[model samples]
Target: MSEHKPVPGHRADYRHFHAIQTRWMDNDVYGHVNNVVYYSWFDTAVNHYLVASGVLDIERSPVIGLVIETRCNYFASVAFPDQVDVGVRVAHVGRSSVRYEIGIFKEGEDSAAAQGHFVHVYVDRESRRPVDIPEAMRMALAAIAVG
Candidate 1:
């Protein structure tokens, strides 16, 4: 049972997508995917976009993104071997933070299996202090941002 609210029309706001296949280990005794797995999907979806954009250098970038907040709401159950469509969009972008909204849908389904958000605050790699988001990074994030 998901404990979060579903944002209407959020599905349409996502401009980027990632495909994630459920694995056997993801299932619990009740025969459904565990709640924690949805969080992983949130990470997978957001990071996939960042990596694809080439603005985030995970290995040696001068700046790094740190997760500050997260939440999810499950509307349906998912099983092993079932592919999921992860829709992503930026709900907000700040000088030093970005809030990514993600909807996890069953493949070919109109609605989401789960919906949630993950917020990342950019910081200095060395100092680990918060810093303004770079122009390039901000632009990349905006490409998928919804109003």
Candidate 2:
């Protein structure tokens, strides 16, 4: 088996942040937040930034991003009543896809409790076929892009 390299979880590594309040139901029987909840945070952070940047319109946009891949790595446990600040950055932008990296930090913490990435393939809303990212969207993404 290959060794896993730890993902960087520093706040300085990301360009944008979105806060999410942990819900009581987010905890699984294991007592910590469920692994699945992290993915939702990732989605929320990235999409929220896009929407706020005026690049995404969930109801009327001609194009929409579809998540094609996702992953997460946990470094610490998070429980109920905690506020998570998810840091977001774009690692790559392709013709029709973007790779968003996210770090989940406890409120006011500089280090992340979890980190992950997801790839979104932009597509035509009606046809469900891949389409070039809109110029406006690309410009929005560029503001947070990293090498």
Per-residue lDDT for 92-131 in model 2, tens only? Answer: 9999999999999999888899998999999999999999
* Worst 10 contiguous positions by lDDT, candidate 2: 1-10
Superposition error at 11 for model 1 (Å): 3.8
* Predictions: Cα RMSD each: 2.9, 1.0
Where does candidate 1 clash, by residue pair?
none
Q: What is the lDDT of residue 103 in candidate 1?
A: 90
What lDDT would candidate 2 get against the real structure? Answer: 0.95
Write down the TM-score of every candidate: 0.92, 0.96
Show the colliding residue pairs in model 2: none
lDDT of 2 at 60: 96
In candidate 2, position 54 carries an lDDT of 95
lDDT score for residue 30 of model 1:
92
- Could you tell me how far off, in angstroms, the CA of residue 112 lies in candidate 1 after the best superposition? 0.9
Candidate 2 Cα outliers beyond 4 Å, as residue runs = none
